[model samples]
Target: MRKTEKIFEVKDFPYPHVIVKDFLDESTLDLVIDALAGLEYDFKESDLFSYWASIELTDIDHPAINILRDDLGDEVWRKKVAKAFGSKSLSSIDMAAYVYGLGDFLLPHDDQVEERIIAYSLHLTPEITEEMGGSLQIFDVDNNNSKLIDSIIPEYNSLIMFEVSKHSWHQVGEILQDIQRLTVTGWYHG
Candidate 1:
């Protein structure tokens, strides 16, 4: 579906979030993917996660980067997204490219960080599958304890946006296949 035709509604299960399939048109997606392919990623690993990540896209001087920044920064688009998530304000955005290879994974955590009102991911892995893992897993939280609730398969051209709060606990499942699970993820800041 074209982005302009998409109706954003938050789903209650697992947490308040919105999934927009076919989020980008073919031409735009191709440009973005090509831009991402030119980026240099660093193999980042920590106690919580392991993946190859490119530096923030905002500082890059690519045409596709400019397109993304402008689109996400557009006042109307920002308002639409903020309203869907019931956020009062969305003043800025931060984005980076990520590649999760075999055995790569991220542990669960609520994306409760400075000024973050919403967290989002735009999946670019066209050949990824549930059996290959790298799914976005949402957790059910009760009394500070979290349990797996749902696993969203990363589909090409799909965009996932969710409210970022204490209850917004999620993680990236390990990648079982020897393939790259590509994504451009970031947050809308209040």
Candidate 2:
């Protein structure tokens, strides 16, 4: 079934967030999933079905949808993301993929890195039941000074957009089932 579009600009959200109307077309997402199914990464061991993923853009011929290579970084998404982050300009963008486990979870941390990064995650895993438990938890660094970022669940063919910099603390919740969570993690440049 096709995933219906949902309201991304919720008034309850503290941080500036915006979900792309058509971030990834179904064909593109499907292609990504197919590529992922045949990928091989011998990194560290994950407690759950989760796996740490990092692929170079050159590996894939699809410039429209790629990861890690500098060529796939489009200005359109960068500009939009920069505005959301309240930044003047965007220096670069990087793409990566995540395959989290059903019971895998990450600690609360910020995406504050070398550049002003606006992050966006596109879910590709189909039929994600609530039991999957791989939700992206974003904290509000302002209002809840102590803590409070929204925990957005991983819905099929959906996008969760946010600004990433030195202060954005976010994490992925654990999945409690035997399903694989796939996502396209985009990072913007300063």
Candidate 3:
């Protein structure tokens, strides 16, 4: 048997996963929010102006997505994620932005694809409260166990990365009143 030298260690989150936080600086986060907020007037009224950004999927070469990967690929973020996965290979990387009055709620589902992906959600909201109901539920499909990962009454800049697979069935609770669920989520491609 070959003895493997493990540098990164994957975590067993409630849904059989792992996570990494605080991948961006406050100033950078501010800049991103500013850029994202500028698009409000351009979008339709139904889109509701709040604040959020997402890593473009279809346009694999989108400029904004390039920026996200450039920023996130920084040594700091990479090292942290490497330590978590106990490996350096990441399959999916994306960013999403959300602000006040986001109407839709993410329903329970698993990320199924031929290629496995690691799910990631970065936090930019300055504050989040339990009643806001933006918590994420990760179900242990195998054991039927579950975990409610609450969003922090967040600070300036924080990121959450996780190992998500087909079994990673998850959902987002509803947002109460008029609030935001500002976050970025994506999966690895490898």
Candidates sorted on lDDT, descending: 1, 2, 3
Runs of candidate 1 with Cα error greater than 4 angstroms are none
lDDT of 3 by residue, 45-66 (tens): 2332222344353345545435
Q: In candidate 1, what residue range of length 10 has the lowest lDDT sum?
A: 1-10
Better of 2 and 3 by lDDT: 2
Candidate 1 residue-wise lDDT, 1-190, digit = tens? 1455454678977789888888777877888889899999999999999999999998888888788666655667678888787778798899999999999999999999989998899899987889999999999899877789889999998889998988899999999989999999999999
After superposition, which runs of candidate 2 have C-alpha atoms over 4 Å from their true positions? 1-13, 45-50, 58-72, 141-145, 165-167
Please report the TM-score between candidate 2 and the true structure: 0.74
Tens-digit per-residue lDDT, 1-190, candidate 2: 1232333442325555665444455665566677766765444344433466758434566534453233225465455555555666887765667777655667666666666456667777788765577777777676447465566767776767666544567778777888878776766666
Candidate with the greatest TM-score versus the true structure? 1
lDDT of each: 0.87, 0.61, 0.52
Runs in model 3 deviating more than 4 A are 1-10, 40-67, 74-83, 98-103, 143-156
Judged by whole-model lDDT over C-alpha atoms, candidate 2 comes out at 0.61
Candidate with the larger lDDT of 1 and 2? 1
RMSD of each: 1.5, 4.6, 7.2
